[model samples]
Target chain A: MAIRKRKSFFDIINEYFGDVEELANQFEDMFMEKPSWSQKNCTMEPLKDVTVTPKEVIVTVDLPLAKEGTIEVKPLDSKTIEISAEMKRKIRFDDFGITHHKGEFQRFYCQTRIPVPVEMDKVKFNLKKGILEVHMPRKRGERIPIE
Target chain B: MSEITIIEKRNIAPDATMLFGFPDVGLVGVIAASHLIEELNLEEVAYVDSKLLPPLIVLHEGLPHSSLRVFANNNILLAVSEIPIAADIIYPIIQALIDWGKNKKAKMMISLSGIPIQERQDAKELKVFAAGSTPEMLKLAKEKGIDILGEGYMVGPQAVMLQKCANMKIPALTLLAQCFYNYPDPEAAAEVLKSLANITGVKVDIKALLEKGEEIRLKARDVMKRTQQELSGIKKAREYDIPLYVS
Candidate 1:
């Protein structure tokens, strides 16, 4: 007869946490689901990324073919910013050899949500080598004095 | 049945330089390989069949084609993968390709790829580095004035191919150009191609490639995202770590 040892307490706790992590990942995939572009908006969504550090939040967007003078970044709210840029030339599905889909996009558009609190007034941005980098200083709460 | 098989659609010439352009940082290999195919006018001679791959078939002009294929001309047999190969299947797939290439008596195998840099966008120029499967290959790269990637953790198909080729005593090399981690970089592709030309004397004009750079980036966005996910799964960032060499 084959015998199996019972799982220890730490093993049970690890397994439970693993399940929780998996569930969290599934939920994130579900909530983050959306098409990368919108034909109605006539805007192609450029790739963007966000990173948070102790001092600041840095957001970078890959804006290929973006005209230097036509780029704009506006704070929509405390935690959200809208970015848009006009491409040097309009792009069409036909440009990509797709005849079935008929649409032309002249701009890139997207909204990024900041995860942590940041100072909106102090936002600064620069465009270089076709990448737009936005820097915002993080907000730190006041320290409490202990008697 | 073998887990991975290379199916030839037509006769493949022996003694050819086998090149690999699997998806990696900045989609370097894919971009370079596409340009090579267009410039060299290479034809598809073979495709990879594997249960290890996902149930995905890329359609071109209403025709089904394997995501992984081998394009060839008189002197070059280029292996190109349209989709990123998952981490678990990388070893087997690369080993199979090495075995196939070896059987064909390939003179040398080279993998065109990229090394990610944090400040890639701001850099005015990109540099290409090389790693070799043998000492002679390293010496050859140096003779051509290419810098050697002396020691680092390279995670992906090219890394696997290099190790496998070394074990089987086949000459192999990997060329990595400095490039963006997340964005498709056609500029890096051009730099690596220049190195390829210098090393092998196989030249292709990069003017057309440079002209269509932005369009390539826009079209390559989805593939780059998928490749990034696969790269993360393979712990690709370990390549950036400075190793403690005991020897």
Candidate 2:
């Protein structure tokens, strides 16, 4: 006969802390309105959407003028990502019928904190039609021995 | 004070068809409206003024302009906004526009917008759908070979416009093209404009719109960002929900 053991107290504590940390991160991301970087000097933050599922977290970014080869996605930590992409050409404010702003932008930058812990080493990304999509698997819960 | 006020810049044709293009999914409406204004050489006819609007003014040619303005030619009036209308004010803003259109004895009102679709990037051809306030309008869309959206949750200004028009017995139709949910999609905008031509019997060259798709996407990023903020406030994701029909 095979016997199944219950989870240890240490495992329960670890999972409880992990879930609380994830919830706090999610609340912060949801409520924070300002971009992590400064907006001066014609710098722009690309619009992004993050969807967290049980298995993975998917992030989609709108990089309007970006070329596929110029995009860079890096994980700053287990819960944070940094994305930057250079535009194919500089876009001037005057090009859009605005003359008050006297500068142009050649790139988009953003740093966002993911609401859930993810496997940073296994992150995968693709840029298509000026949109960048990143998929990261959720970190597996640690296993503990049952006495 | 009224929640929204329309200030007329010039006398407009009373029987013209009115078109509305506000910021929404894919930024489709704004792009299509801008193209229509350029192609048809529509001139400013009126503008909306509201205290509820954010404290912002747009400058063009060294002249101050309302963030939300109306343009018109002999056959049509186009109402477009440079910024996304906040969710709290969408109801009043759309109400005021519909009331003004009704008072002007406009023949019909049409809203050009987009419906978000999953896997939009993989779509080779986008399809346009229509929802009408009346059966007569639905028949018109059918004759024009546009699919009818029988059931779905609609968000933003167009959703309010449709409801108000229905209540006022004004003929209105909303044309929605399938598009990416969170990206500026000029291709979807082009598709919506093509559908507009069929329904309104108005034609404009779309070659330029397609050629400058990337440029438009770039220029519209700021507005799209603001729109993304307002969309969250309005619970715009309800547009994707499956509705429970209480028949």
Candidate 3:
């Protein structure tokens, strides 16, 4: 049988903060209608997905045509991962059959926000088939004693 | 004016097999339909104009065109959309397309798409599954050695197509390949197309598609992002739920 225990004060506070942070992230997503590319920076945003499990938070970014050796992932903070990669070739707007907007993108860049608290220092990642997956184990919460 | 209309530029031949490929998971349909168009040299015969759609228009060869268009040759008439079909407009758009295809005396209708699978990245081989409008169509797919999509919720344009086609008594089937839900999957697209060929005997070279997989994924990122946004509005996550049909 599974043990049942009452929530502790720290647990309640953690849950509240998590919900608030998640809501704020949703709000940020709602009001932002920015394009995926930056003409000034010549950087194209790669598509990414984040999955939060009980054990870890896994973030995967699709980086097709990205130079494997040039891929970089840095922990921006406790909750964000910034990834950058150099593309094999410069992609010009003309290459997409658009000559009007003159710009050449030489790299892929994006930031992934993790929802749950995780150990950023113990992060592990690998690139396979041009897909980069970063795995960070979740930070353990305080345990409550069961009677 | 009707809310949606298919304006025909060239006369379409009757008894053609109508196919649908709209933006959905992994962009399976769009990618497969695009490849079909290129390999078959299908020409634009009709375009769907709708007030329900956004004001955006696709620019091709410096000429503006509808985002939703129909391309055809002698035996195949394909309906493809370059943009994501919003949740609200899905019903009318699909009904209109079905009506148009029926009017054209389309022999059969098939929708190419993808079904999301967990950990698709590690899978060594992908399988294509089919859901048909009627039992006979399902049996036909079984005879052709394609797995049947017997149960599970289907989301997006392909779902609408299957439901509408079933009600209209039109022979239709949806061929879905296992694919990543949020990423552009060219391999899944190719798998779906091979099943399409088995069913329709309309085959095309997939070598070029596989070779340019990276390039296609790179170019398709923006569209996939927008499609992902639209997908959530439709409660696409519900597809993962198990249904209980107890009365």
Candidate 4:
């Protein structure tokens, strides 16, 4: 008579890798070839746009399905302005063979540089079309300056 | 094999230089890599070959340039390269990197990446997150103000390297920026870059990153619209933990 024993995860892993290393290696190679770095698949933006006006540069960024007051902008260097926003969203996995659960996540950060340095005190921003816009005067000689 | 031509073959040198940058997750890695090659005048060391995989071109600047790759755009390298999420592929890829770094007498491995977090990115702050295998590495991460990941899974090349480095007992650290995932967020990249600059004292321009982000945002929006329509019936609306923030 033989006794049946329960198998543990460790035993299974050892048996699988020890005996089937070659098969595992081949299978692994296939996946290593796929690129997962591209932002093509995700529904988010890493940067926003701001149009430069004669008086000031109008910066715009998209933040759909988000309420106001989540984005903040600040001037860093003579030519740089920093922007950061936070939006919390819930993720549900009930549809994919997974039980219903709420998963919340926040997406944030970005920085922009003006063509020329601008006065930090003279910057203005607005959010429209799910886009945030900032207006700032162009710095003197920030444009085409005479040598 | 009949007349298989190997375009380039190279190896890591002693005290292998660790180049950190963001890849596709943001423009950081790609731009950083390109810039490092140009700034340091690094030569093409080797070209990684994997069908359907993006080119993994290694650049050597004099002697294993220990600088980060800056993108043509404003993005900086948050993580070094693309990471395959699947466990099967993840394990072996890490193994190869471990072996390569070891053979090169490398002391540690470094990677960079950015995550979309939900915070008004208007300020000069982009919450940075970090993870490492060794105690020393974690300490380094703390030294940099990068949040240490306690319990979670990162599904990219950086994640795979973390696991592999842990197994090999190699010191590794990954820096990630809180970024908006919906569009090419160069601003986020810039914030992350600032942190990297603080860590490495590397100066970079944000213009290229801004332009790249704008371009990526436009394209991604178009693709998302199409994908949403095409995948409507086939799959349920996939919700992501967007605008992610670290505690």
Candidate 5:
């Protein structure tokens, strides 16, 4: 075994500042527009099927871990609906034997533009097994007239 | 020359240099920080790449005496205020905070978070945790009745900030409260904020949270109704089967 001599104070300072500068460069790269995993606010799982009935357009959204409240639906047109929801929550890192505690998070303002004109006034919503369902009634005038 | 400005609202000297976490992770530290900034009348000292891909805003404030920079983004505002656990390192991101913190001569830093929990789902009692630079910090943690957990993986910006601070030899601690994993839990955030106010001696008005809670509650209920209806059609069907094994 050979004994290794300690580095000089100047060497340590140089190394420390050098690492800091490298960290600065790394920060620049991290802040850059990163693709493939950018979205951080809301996790959206688009429904498997958005069925349009003669009287109503049934829009289903896969929202697991969703609360019974916090969904907002706005109708843009006879064929378009905008959906927004928020889920505010807190998490203890301890009970889970965790070290970090992310505080006072209200997962709100998750928005989605739905393709289908639904009646805003008569809109219906439901939550089951972490899934969200929205029923938008079709506009009366949009229906085909039968003589 | 790096441009710097000083903000003198009051002579309020901050004991801990806080790395204000994102909006919705452990409990909404960033939002609380925003509220503090508003309350203290802090001024913007710098802007670091607010127009990056995801978009973030960095502001500087030397409160009463201490100088520190706060980095935030529109994404943080637009986000659901949840802890981001995306499996990306963003190591460079943490380094940036270090650089920013060092520029202000910050001796110690704190990161805030909210963890999801099943117990106390309805009740509110935020537990504080600490991960410091040395044994002295650990002693402080014991004095505060705060547990110092040795290990666990943390998510989002705070996680990165913690690593950076530790690596840079800056005393750092992460405070978090228990929260629901799968729902918008404003009450939980409120609890965490109250604890934070107590810890940092920052005054926080709960009026905004109450108002926001009502608005969000109504929306959550509506969404839950719709979700239930959609899932009603899904049912499980099982058939009895006999397995054949080869001799």
Candidate 6:
């Protein structure tokens, strides 16, 4: 009694290309060194973990000393995330018993690439105990029931 | 040529309890050892030298010092490494250290270290576990209310230390606190030190260490990064896998 909508030829081709693009992006991230800005100055690249599941991609960043309400998470594109946060106080080199380096750090900055295509508009984030967790749903085609 | 050589600068008591603090999960041992050195006012008594080691020297007060050094007072001899030890050298290096400890007639040996937990960040209270190389050491740990690590894969310098100590018949125990695998966890270090005090009667106030936890984490990032690199080469992920029970 019900009619099923068929996927068009162009839609199938687009899906195939999307998968290829994701695979290529993953390969690049695996082989290429990520571009980081920490070498220039006092900026630090916060340690992070990315776990991709069937439903969503979860990213957790360790941002110790990060102040509440000063953290920002922005999507550079559908496949990239930019995270920045201000530390509660400036940490001097002397603080760690290193007096030779006369510098201080007040911020944590990093740009992480997501391996899978994500629905950027639906990205959600939460910062707790100085750890930032970002969740984004995987981009997938509509599911159809098989008769 | 020996893979490692320990050059003694000062003679310590023959009945000393040697403590090993090598870089491992959470950098717990190194942090705990640094705290012990400062709090106990331990002096550099020996240094390890080897061509196999990467050309690295730590500077203190504008003076160059070996990356692997031993500190001691009257009753305690502490061996600590500023950098991570390469995997290929762990067995030989640990064997040498244990043999040297035996030559020194150390009564007992203990290694301060950490065990990684999946939800370390969410843990409200961290627990310290002990793995003893001998039954006497295990009994002592039980007497001190320290939980025994019933069975698990331990991968690092401490693992080799435990193995060598067992073969040499030296009483050794490895203390591990639940902690973040990649993060410098001073709080976990404090917990391990507390356990150390309980078992060995070597006491050091951990207030300053606890107060400066965040700053220590911030500064230890570079060392932690290097340690993470070495961790892969050492197959540290084995610590996370369930060990098979083979009779």
- The native-contact fractions of the candidates, in order shown, are 0.60, 0.80, 0.75, 0.10, 0.00, 0.35
Off by over 4 Å in 6: A1-42, A97-102, A140-147
lDDT (10s digit) by residue, model 2, range B136-238: 9999999999999988899888889888988988999999999988889999999999999998888888999999898887677777877888888899999
Residues A87-106, candidate 4: write the lDDT tens digits: 54522233122343333334
Task: Tell me the TM-score of model 2.
Answer: 0.86
Per-residue lDDT tens digits for candidate 2, residues A53-134, read: 8899999988876877888899987778999888777777677786655677777888778888899999999977777889
Tens-digit lDDT track for model 1 on B76-127? 9999999998998998999899899999889999999999998787788999
Off by over 4 Å in 3: A1-28
lDDT of 5 by residue, A6-32 (tens): 999999999899779767756764465
- The TM-score measured for candidate 1 stands at 0.90
- Give TM-scores for every candidate, taking all chains together and pairing residue i with residue i: 0.90, 0.86, 0.92, 0.46, 0.44, 0.88
Task: List where candidate 4 sits over 4 angstroms from the true fold.
Answer: A1-147, B1-12, B20-24, B52-91, B119-124, B200-247
Off by over 4 Å in 2: A1-43, A97-102, A142-147, B1-3
- Per-residue lDDT tens digits for candidate 3, residues B1-247, read 7999999999999999999999999999999999999999999999999899899999888789999999999899999999999999999999999999999999999999999998888889999999999999999999999999887788888999999999999999999999999999999999999999999999999888999999899889889998998999999989899988765
Please, what are the lDDT tens digits per residue for candidate 6 over residues A1-147?
A: 899999999999999998898778779856766532253566778878888999999888888899978888899977789998998988776776866567777789887889889998999998766668899999997889999
DockQ numbers for every candidate? 0.49, 0.48, 0.65, 0.06, 0.02, 0.38
TM-score, candidate 4, is: 0.46
Residue A90 in candidate 3, Cα distance off native in Å: 1.6
lDDT winner between candidates 1 and 5: 1
User: Cα-based RMSD of the predictions, in order?
Assistant: 9.5, 5.3, 5.5, 23.3, 23.2, 4.4
Highest TM-score scorer:
3
Give the Cα error of residue B107 in candidate 2, in Å. Answer: 0.5
Name the lDDT value of residue A113 in candidate 6.
Answer: 87
Cα error, candidate 5, residue B115 (Å) = 0.9
Query: Second chain TM-score per prediction?
Result: 0.98, 0.98, 0.99, 0.62, 0.60, 0.98
lDDT of each: 0.91, 0.87, 0.93, 0.52, 0.48, 0.88
Q: Of the pair 2 and 4, which is ahead by lDDT?
A: 2
